[model samples]
Structure formats: structure tokens, C-alpha cells
Target: MATLVLAACGTDAAAPADRDDVGARVFAANCATCHGPDLGGTDRGPPLLHEYYLPDHHPDVVFATAIANGVQAHHWDFGPMPAIGGLSDDEVAAVVAHVRDEQRRAGLME
Candidate 1:
């Protein structure tokens, strides 16, 4: 797992106040094992905070699709990702929101 520590800013204009807590909880429960608590890559998955994951390249829809159907390894050498079952659409959306928030916090996205 790759660990990335970024300096936190006082405020993030892009983060939704309502979604933040839900997103964080959802991500921590389901994604943190592989994606890390900070969205950094774990031994099991690639980092979501990288430039390759910036919204311009990987849109919100792409995330939803990936979570529902799984994604073949294209960027990282971590191998193919399996579909994550048992997550509702809302949960998936919250996870994406959390990841995007972390990305912005890391300055990987605007």
C-alpha cells in the first residue's frame, strides 16, 4: 500500500456538507481496507487520489459503473477488480463523493 499524506486546508468549497459524513462512513466501512482511509492505495487496490483518477478522466458515472460491475486493470498493476456487492446505489454514490473529496484535498483534482 502506498501512503500519501497531504496538508489539510481550512475549507473545501467542493465538498458537500451533507454528504461528507455519510460518504466518509460508507467509504471507511467498505473501501478503506483496500483504498485506505485516506484514499491512498493499499496492497489490494490502486489509489483513488492519483491524477489518473481526476474527474476529467474518470467521471462520476465511471465510478458507479466500476463499483457495480468491477473494472479490469488498465492503469495499475494490481490486477483486475471484482464487483463489490451489497452496496446500494446511494452507498456507491456516497463512496464516490468521499473519494472525490479526498482527491480534491490532495490537490489531484480542482
Candidate 2:
């Protein structure tokens, strides 16, 4: 797995409310099925807010790729995530921002 630093997104002081709204919408529309509404993970997927993931995997580029292209099922057998082709680059960025912020608030991101 890649060790992605959280600082790359810059100071966590820019448009937080907007990020949260975008993030919630993106997650609801695309990730809620697998990741769950509260981001607590689900039977079909691992928790995004867990200590094992959020901190190390929150890089913008990595997340962008994961959302835009989908990830290969390397650590789990559930399978790769389908490409969220419906989202534009800006939308993807917002989602990533949302995930990072929420994780950070949850004390999962560093």
C-alpha cells in the first residue's frame, strides 16, 4: 500500500463547509452503497474512517485515481470498485476533500 501524506491538500482551512457538502453528496450517490452512509464501513467494504486507512491513503492524487478509475481488489475479495465515470474532475476533488475532512474530524486523518 502507498504511504500518502495528508498535507498535500494544503491547510485544512479552505472552504470546509463546501467540501463537506460535496463530500456528503458524492459519498451518498457513489460510495454509500458500499461504504455506508456514516462512513463507518459496511458488510461489503472496509471502513474508510479506520486507523488503518484514512491517514496513510488520503493523498489527493491517489484518492482521485481511486474514485475516477476504481481500485483493484488487492487486500479484499469483494472486488475492485467500479469507475465513477459520472463525476468530473472537480467533483472528484470535492469528494476527496470531503473524505479527508471527515476523516480528519473523526481523528482518522493526521
Best by TM-score: 1
Clash-forming residue pairs, model 2: none
CA shift at 48, candidate 1, in angstroms? Answer: 0.7
lDDT (Cα, 0-100) at 46 in candidate 1: 89
Each prediction's whole-model lDDT (CA): 0.74, 0.70
Per-residue lDDT tens digits for candidate 2, residues 27-101, read 899988888888787888767777645635545677777776788876567778787778765566667777777
RMSD (Å) of each candidate, 1 decimal: 8.8, 4.5
Off by over 4 Å in 2: 1-14
* TM-score of decoy 2: 0.77
* Model 1 lDDT per residue over 1-110, tens place: 00101111123333575667877998888778888888888999988988888878987777777877889999999888888888766667767777888887888777
Lowest summed lDDT window (length 10), candidate 2: 1-10
Candidate 1 colliding pairs = none
